[model samples]
Target: MASCKQVESMIQAWIDGELGDSERVILDQHFQECPLCTITLRKQQRCAALLFEGFADHRLRHSIRQRVMENLPEMEPLRVDLEGVNWRGHDTKPKRAWLGPLMRMAAVFILICLASLLYSAWPKGEKNFDGAVGMITQTEGAAFRETGHGLFCRSVALKDFVKFGAFYKTGPNSHLMVSLRGPTQLRIDENTRFQICDDRKIRVETGRVALDVSRDERKFRVLTPSGTITVYGTVFEVSVDSVQTLVTLQSGALQVESAGAQGELKPGEQTCFTRGQNAITTRTVDTAQVLGWTKAIMPDSEAYDRFAREVQPLKIAELPGEQVFAVITTKNGKPRAVSSFCLAWNPATDGEERCGYDVHVYNEAMHELFSVHVDGSVFANPNRRSHEIDAPGAPIVNAGVLHVKIVPDNSAGKQTPLKVSAVGL
Candidate 1:
């Protein structure tokens, strides 16, 4: 019914059930009588059964093809003779039997890469806080908690959740620090009691707190006795006394509202709210003065030597080559005020002073509150004290830590250092 050549070509299709009824009938009739073709058909059936059993996952096959198509660049389509030994080569086996094994091996590697890609693209679930908002990251001294039952002092570990309306207080010499899921850090200072409203809001009933907020779109807020502040990704300090509330922005920005009036603050700005009508004021402040709590503990001599070398070439003849006459006035052992450390090498001739010192005065917070440049030729009396010199716009002495840095000026000269101690004011 069918020729040997036709039987050879149609055997695979017949085994796969892809032959039409007439073609199948002809193939069946030929196979019943032809021993050679019957053996070939049996081999084809075995091969098909093995392939289907080995790679039966339909989705896996689809994924492999999809991944290869999507990730690789476009290429020309390739056609292979089903009966050939190999692609593009007549040397392929009689039925191209190597194709199935080659594709199977390739599928293994592709599946690994595709699995990795899919896993990476998958979304991570939302962060869990249980029911509370934040946890205590660090604590020093005794911290107390007020609950519906009663007030109790307890030992807590890091990562203990702080819930809404929970009142937390610190004993003397005690401090508490909190970290939140939003990546916010709050340092609760000594003798402080505050109630948490939410993850981003706090009410300070008393004492002080420092906030270091990471850059984020979410807004943080603080409520004080006399005013409120809305925080926006910045470092700042807030102090609430019985009579007033003080806010200092070391970096970033905030909005202050008090006494029915509102004001905006940028970096190096401060605002004060007193408990009275029309008692709100905002102004530029010295960052070091307000943030004096973070002062570096460098000695006066080291500070002077450091600045001296930094302003080198201009020498102070009154002191050692590496030393400058830098005096720090303190209140209760904290730097409270500073005297102008003057250097007199650049002569003031023709109504211009060339060589001298640029003095920066900082408070205990290590904030440069103000600066003054003492004219080198202006201080005629070497015996005159620093305060006697009438330097314009000199900073007033205040109660707090004081730090001074003097930078030598030889701008009028070839900008070289004068290796001498010119004079001290």
Candidate 2:
């Protein structure tokens, strides 16, 4: 009979249907008698099921779906003809005779156009200027170039190529996240410079980069700030913080060593080192947290700015008793002279009683730009209305510092002051 620890180790494999027959027999016999092992196996099975369910849900995010689709070149549509008529037993019309070939030609042309569009849309490759570099592609955008000194932010589309680089910085903040399309290998050299040579070998100079390697057969390696990292296929995160270096294996297995103190790290295992030290300590770390850099979300400034810009009111002035106002401001902070003004108004009491008012806008120089009128009337009662004003473009040239004045209706006596106040954008 196996010990409890040994049984527990094999239980997950058994539930997953991954154990060999001999291992299965041993587990089955033990489960029949050991209530603890049986319960443990059942619990593990449930956990596996839940984990898979969560994974399925996560795969639905747009980023994951886009990546999956990009990798599946086989899904590209094939061209085919649909207009061919069968002539096995009967005669076909002359128009039908040419239809099959015509359709085929059309399909070919469409396929060629589609392929060209997709190729143009693919992500552009990046050249590493320093420590290291890699290439990434999608169906859009030009190739991107990236260099690593410390931590860097990249567009999600650039993440697929796993191209990254790092250089020695005396300060503490040197880190970078290199996106990967598949499992990648990187090498760091002590005071050296190198590039990701294909997807198999990583050339490095005297700096190190943390790697979040995927599970694909793509070879992953790193030239370190001090030495080299050779890895078997696995998912792991590696980092070199100054004189110290660390490698954390989240899944599968990996080998790490510096100055000949070598250690094999299994899933959930991590190793750390300092220069000239042979001591290697193995500890457990959360794999997801360590590799979180690979999947980190970047902040979007443009979208945030757009929202902020649209929410604020433009700097136009409103009439005192009116519900709405018109504003004018320069693109920057500068102000210009307003030489003319026009207002078309609506009467609150009746639609037919509306009238127009002509107002002149002038600059400090007393130059006239153009003029128009407000087409509504104001009585003692508050009447809400709006009007459009047209002016020559010349007066608004220097955008900042412009002033507007409303000319009262001569028929209503100058006593009626157009209630007005200025607002800033």
Highest lDDT model number: 1
RMSD of each: 24.2, 37.0
For model 1, state the Cα shift of residue 280 in Å: 3.3
TM-score of each: 0.38, 0.29
The positional error of residue 185 in candidate 2, measured at the CA in angstroms, is: 8.9
Native-to-model Cα distance after best TM-score fit, residue 33 in candidate 2, in Å: 99
Q: How close is candidate 1 to the true structure, as a TM-score?
A: 0.38
Error of 1 at 163 (Å): 1.5
In model 2, the runs with Cα more than 4 Å from the true position are 1-134, 137-194, 203-219, 297-425
What tens-digit string does per-residue lDDT give for candidate 1 at 145-172?
6654444344443445667777888778
The whole-model C-alpha lDDT of candidate 1 against the native structure comes to 0.60
* lDDT string, candidate 2, 365-406, tens digits: 445445555544543224554343545554455533233545
